[model samples]
Target chain A: MQFLSIFHEINGDLKVVEKELEKYVLTQEPELTLAAGHLLKAGGKRIRPAFALLAGKFYRYDFEKILPLAVALEIIHMASLVHDDVVDASMTRRGHPTVKAKWGNRVSLHAGDYLSAVALKLISQYQDKRVLKVLSRVTVEMCRGEIQQISASFDAEQNLRDYLYRIKRKTALLISASCELGAVVTEAPEKIVRALTRYGYHVGMAFQITDDILDMISDEKVLGKPIGGDLRQGIITLPVIYALKHSQEKEHLRELVTKQVKSEEEVQEIIRLIKDSGAIKYSFDMANIYLNKAKKELNRLPDVKTKKTFKKLTSFIGERSF
Target chain B: MQFLSIFHEINGDLKVVEKELEKYVLTQEPELTLAAGHLLKAGGKRIRPAFALLAGKFYRYDFEKILPLAVALEIIHMASLVHDDVVDASMTRRGHPTVKAKWGNRVSLHAGDYLSAVALKLISQYQDKRVLKVLSRVTVEMCRGEIQQISASFDAEQNLRDYLYRIKRKTALLISASCELGAVVTEAPEKIVRALTRYGYHVGMAFQITDDILDMISDEKVLGKPIGGDLRQGIITLPVIYALKHSQEKEHLRELVTKQVKSEEEVQEIIRLIKDSGAIKYSFDMANIYLNKAKKELNRLPDVKTKKTFKKLTSFIGERSF
Candidate 1:
């Protein structure tokens, strides 16, 4: 099935979020407007906002009441990505020039700053301090995750635990907050909110795992950037960590991947070596475990059509190859 | 009277804010805690937080209720300064190595990001949404101000209006919010809130103008950084702008200040030329206008002791040479 199928029911609502996102990012400064709006135009899957919108539907769902939060979740995601690019000194994202690429580091830094403040503005409109609290805590963790990743980069001795902790904060925490805050905004009951939060957390972990795997094997065209990009940058994702610990060519993998600079050929060779090992299967099984845990969380929810959609989303994540 | 006397009444209260600031910055990541706490250890005036605390005293002021906000205000100031150092590539602040200098730009960037999130967390303690709203809006404007300064840097053509707008957002807005949020969190009457906010705004403007003037003539040892640092960076301030337009050697001044780099001799010469041009007096006049306007706003408030402090603050800002 197409990945679009999971969000098909809410595509119209997502479109509203997309439109409002443009307006929310507009500012008095033209250059700022351009830089802050740059990533939104480039576009992502809108998965976090979709997760939020879907989670909000589990209770007294009002689209207008929930729209600001949905938009804010996506903006938070975009804000982090903008700063991430600055940290990485990345020149491109989504096959287009990144904000950091067009503007200098200073503009990109303030653009990210402006976006984060904008997100706060949107979340503040909800009047529930819980939403702001959850986001603030999660955003802090997200920043810590980014700092950890920077510190952990190119370290051959980093363990599986290190990789998990990093990804948990870097990706899973915000995704989990999306679901939790969505339920909170909709006034979902305690049980429902907890279930959805755990579900989102598990799905987020699996999603990031799948992304790590795809970074090795996905067509560069499909991924919209180079394959092994993470490896080239010494991020040492799940598969690489697994290969470093368990693969037949562990020594060579460690030496090559831990190198400060990797040639294109070196990156390709490392990718090939990891693929030939069982790391891909090992990583897939791990992701499936998370998918199963995510499905178990839906079992706690009331038998609504949304639950069925949740099942399909998990299944899609399980079988997703790209 | 000394600058310390302005906050003498709140010395103990400011101490609480200082202690809480240390605890607020602690994270699971020790390096992050260190980087975020570095500036806190290197003391500042605690002026923004003191403004909030003092402003909280006008009506129904509860010390415990406002303490979180006071600490949060200082954290916000530190966060901006940390990010500002990155934007300026400044290696030192407050006569010490900056976060950007001790750690890399990436660490400093994430450190700033983490501090901002912590500020949001602190503000979330209030059930009232207005505090968040005011903060979010002010923070966004602050970012826009920073970006404007970057874009305006080194451009010889910027006018007084450009400098005014930039400083309004860059300095005045947050200081205004500091006083405004204190009034808000204390549930002060709307009339009083408006008075304190305007008071903060005008005082902030004068405060920045005074800093700009001092940047040209203050002792390097007293100012804690090199004199003429702003002029050297191509940031045209009010006094420099005045000199650029009115000095006998306007062309020479412009040529020297606008150069991408300057030797110590050129910096000294540029400072001497601007000081001799009557630009210092012109800039001082602008600052006094703001201070006088700030004092007038206090007349609308109740005859509380805090109002008297506000008056003295304006006076101190007017005449403080250091």
Candidate 2:
């Protein structure tokens, strides 16, 4: 909510986008409508759509022209989340039952697919080929990253570079594409587009790192999910990677993670090891590095009110606690 | 093999599509390449691409221009199959282990999604918004149909219309889209495009009915899967619907289908009831009606050499023993 406050000036446009998203979610099929509504009702930060709208502000801002693209990006994000929960066998998301949990994996899979197809259909209405190309490429990369993550799971041998590459594709690439697409759809200057894209990349990296930190340290009530959920599922995030590389108890940590931990006590023990290993500080420093790079890229953009909003968004990303 | 040989005149073009499909399947990720390769290697008739190319022949045909569309359609088909197997929990397709069977559901899900994204990216190379629009709409419909099928599984209350609508979206729409896309991409006259699309729709309906019939009666070795596969999975196909409607043992049949049949004998008993119900003849006649309709639509096109080939393809669909 604090992050979304940055869009106070454009609240009406955001409301329109929210309505458009709701409109798109209505399908002829009842089950699909229910599944989509469930996810939409769970609510999100709508960060991708916000980035798209913010990027459009740098150029000529027409809310109607950008509304479809914004809605499409949000749908894509929601679609991915539905499938991600299935892949992770997760029970809850953001304090709510997942689509997979509520409707079952089979329904969740098709629902996710339906939402993605809807996104493509909506985006196809636009004439810009580049926007479609970017979104398509990013979608493919995101899937590739997911496949990589699945294959790499429980493999304690993975290095920092592998982790970074996976996160770049899984998280950063889509956010960057969201920023790039906003500019491309609005036909912003090439320089401004490139700068926003870079800014998005850095911000996304920082954003994911911050998320990893939250997964480690945040309370379940605040985080909206159990802490250390990623580690429990054998998903190695930045803190885990750093702890594995630099901690003296690396072998013990690997042993605990490489095999399934059957008890809650074991999971807590692993979390304690990760925290005491100095990995949290290292991860925060890495996120700060990306945040600085993001701020630098924002300096390249022209002097506009939206530029300040972009910077504020980046800070919000950096300072977000949960 | 006999059906594919009908493409003798366009053999070179078909080969180009095959090679392009192979090229697209190659990926930097080993597991994805392997999973996609497994599905591709366990081949189908390539009927959808053939429909696309045949539709292309009505206009000034360019093999190169039509290849990507053909390949994209095939990839979309393959991707759906990967996901479908997961949904049905099927063990084999075409005498080979399914992606889900070999790689687990998680990998299969992501692999299916990756292939879909690749199809979109490849199609985006063409500037035709109509092609994107058709593909996107068809993909959405296909997902909707799957969700409907799942939600309506073992539904004794489903009518003939419900069955037809499901198959139209699940099987026929893509085939229809293939033919329509081929004509659209080749810049065929609107009259010819509409005719081919109608032809594809009828043929696709017939194809799915034939497939449903085959699922009931075909030999395991010949069909590359166990008979009664769809019934076991509670997928209420045309034959099953017909059987439930006309069989004197309708109550018993419904009882057997609505509950989990735990043994081979129970499945075989249900098959016997369906066969004795004269559902086989009803299904074949229903398929022939569509085949005749498809032939009628083909006659609306110009009497090009490809017209004869299209007629032969329709007969092959109707007459396929396996």
Residue runs of model 2 more than 4 Å from their true location after superposition: A26-28, A87-103, B87-103
Question: What tens-digit string does per-residue lDDT give for candidate 2 at B36-64?
Answer: 78777887788889889989999999777
Q: How far is B212's C-alpha from truth in model 1 (Å)?
A: 0.8
- CA lDDT, every model vs. true structure: 0.84, 0.84
C-alpha DockQ for predicted model 1: 0.55
- The candidates' DockQ values read 0.55, 0.57
lDDT of 1 by residue, B84-181 (tens): 65642221332343334333667778989989988998998998788999999999889888888878887889999999999999899889988998
Kindly list the per-residue Cα lDDT of model 1 for residues A70-140, writing each as its tens digit. Answer: 99988888888777656322223323334343336677788889999999988888877789889999988
TM-score of each: 0.94, 0.94
Each model's TM-score for chain A is 0.94, 0.93
Candidate closest to the true structure, highest DockQ: 2
Candidate 2: clashing pairs of residues = none
